[model samples]
Target: MNVMAKAEKKISSAFIYFFGSFGGILFGYDIGVMTGALPFLQADWHLENAASLVGWITSAVMFGAIFGGALAGQLSDKFGRRKMILMSAIVFMVFSVLSGVSPDMGEASAYYLIIVRMLLGLAVGAASALVPAYMSEMAPAKARGRLSGLNQTMIVSGMLLSYVVDFLLKDLPGEWAWRLMLGLAAVPALILFLGVLRLPESPRFLLRKGDEAQARKVLSYIRKNPAEIDQELASIKETAKEERQANQKTSWSTLFSGKYRYLVIAGVGVAAFQQFQGANAIFYYIPLIVQKATGQAASSNLMWPIVQGVILVVGSLVYMWIADKFNRRTLLMVGGAVMGLSFILPVVINWMMPNMNPMTIVVFLCIYVAFYSFTWAPLTWVLVGEIFPLAIRGRASGLASSFNWIGSWLVGLIFPIMTASMPQEAVFAIFGIICILGVIFVKTCVPETRGHTLEEIEEQGTNHGRVKANNPEN
Candidate 1:
């Protein structure tokens, strides 16, 4: 009631938001830092062992990410988001130090890099899943989109840091410079580990496990006050009661028992295409592409990534603003369109080079970033997390996340081959087609989850004319 107390509460809430969001930074850092380190690794390690050696080296992290993402869904569902993330942070710290100190390419066993990348991918995958899960649970109902949107911001910012490190260390010996750049990630990993260690358990996770007391403990901080807590708990219980009822009948066959099948397919499919749309094509290979484009030295390529990081960060920031103003479905639709169109920019730039103005192509690239960061990047995670039922959420998110990582690994595994085997036109064309398909998928299947409680989201999908979340005890 007092001015200072009110201000203190506001500051406390802001701090929670900041700390909650720091997980995203780790996710972003893990994704981007590899680029800066890869060139050094090739030279230090005998990546020449196979004709596809470079591809194996690069795809190794994604391969690990595949398993990591799958592990996150099941683990987070059972262990709680905060705890799972802390465990992930430990992985990050260990890998960060080991990756940096890995013996030079000649002396270091090729398997060493593969093993470390796989381990790091586990950390990245866990952080990616848990950060969104935590943000979705803690954010105010009205601000969920924006709050979850922070994950995108943190990811891009983390990526920006990698670029900055890459730029600063560009001139250093790749082996030495890459090590330091990567090892620096340990700092954020430690911070996430310590900070989340002090955080409360997710109220929803608690409720899912029937721990009302601890749920209330977390809700007490997240809600405005005791009255607000009461109001929230009432909704949670109502929604949870529905989930509890749903669990009575939920089974392995539940995914296809009725209307729920379409949802499962659509949800997982959309999440999968987020990568198929070739977003990672840019994220993972931009450095190498940029190095080729400007005739810049390897280190200078990082500056282009900083440009990309800026575009990605700014676009995602806009999602926080627009996620509320417009229809969630509409944002997704328009974003897909823009992204689909933008895919042609690269092909066009490659076309117009040596003859036409390149600025137009440059502008398109930024616009492409703008469209994706604002739309699919944040919205996909929000929808996936909110769209499934609690009984199946664990299985659903696990299954869906695995789908996502599989797509990610597909890109990682095939992109190098694609680059080596195909022309640039073919790569951009593949992504453009995938984006078009994503737009169709969204329009046809996914629901608009705006203003719905977690309970309501589950109710939207029904089985045999009965609410899936309200099945009678059998």
Candidate 2:
């Protein structure tokens, strides 16, 4: 690898990272945008909605996401990555505009809002399932974890952008600001649509489609040398060959056939548990929880959510820079610890905040957000991509991702209910317990994916060998 060629490959990887993560940006944006937008919407619509209803409004996207994820595996295989994302961009662009512009729940039904959100979730669902797959496929093998981490970066970037937009609109009167914030999402959707237009299809997908020449073209662009291209493709081919032998009937039952159950189990279990870890309870309900903690109303407490967003950005940047250096499993366990501990941070401060200065409460919240971002925020996406086989990668990922969204739905739905039923202290403690258990799961089940190529990831599924975090790649 000459310096010039290496430089060109780096440039190519950058483009792949850029375009691939753009979907994640939308993922992050939609996830956070609604949390900030909802407080005003309930008031503007003149509805006497409770916190539970608001939670439903926020989670509607996640609910629809379940189907979106279930279908993406087939869609990505049948239609390819570029088309799936383009279609998703179209869905969110139209749905977001309409969600903001809805007239009346009675005439349109509050169900209209739910329908629109589900549509938005569908787009995000597609993005969530396919973006990581596309990013993983396009990345250089040596840089896979960092490259895949781009999706998580986008997720945090979205979470942060939502808060930033919310803060800017804090002074705006009525729900118009929230409407504008929701509408603003179309910007990234449009960018993703156009940017992906210029982007090529994944070489791995192309190879699956039997376009060897086109696959080689994409492979050459992503890899440094002609030989590296061959090596990359060789691994992909080897994995695909092994997957085909595992069986091709395309049933979940087929996943149980041969050794594929390992993949199906690993992918789906991690995806579901990733969400079940209770990280999203904070992501979706941060604003509500913030208000409860201080006994403040939504307008006054806007800063509470903004602080959370900024911390997530800081955490992701730090994690992205260091992802390759540590074991992926250790990072997961560590992130769970950060999250589990942070859940207790507010309990320590809620008592002191009335007598203490506003700055004191802010500091505590910042620490919580920092720990969440650095640990659980990005690693969820990291493991999701690594835990499947080539054959079931699509189906299994779709199932896992749907399960992830379902777990998200559970958090989004139940957080409000739990908050209603339990003391804020109890809710926080429950999340801490979830993370503590997640730590045990990481130690017992999750495999390390750092420093391995996609080919190497594929080999694990077929060979029945699990890579431990501390073990060196042989």
- Candidate 1 at 213: error in angstroms? 2.8
- How many Å off is the CA of 141 in candidate 2? 2.2
Stretches of candidate 2 off by over 4 Å are 1-11, 47-49, 105-109, 244-247, 344-365
Steric collisions counted per model:
2, 1
Give model 2's TM-score versus the native structure. 0.91
TM-score of each: 0.88, 0.91
Question: In candidate 2, residue 269 scores what lDDT?
Answer: 69
Question: How many clashing pairs does model 1 include?
Answer: 2
RMSD of each: 5.1, 4.0
Residue 42, model 1, lDDT = 60
| lDDT tens readout by residue for model 2, 1-474 | 477445444436567679877898888888888777777776776543476677778899899899998787678878898888889899989988988787664524466787788888988898899888887778775677777888888888887888789778867976687788888888888988987876778888888777887788777776669888888788788767765785566777766666666556666766776677676776676667667766677666667676677777878888888877878778777777776776666566666564544344335446656766766667777666766766666777778789899999888888888878887666776777787887887787666667777667657755754665586364
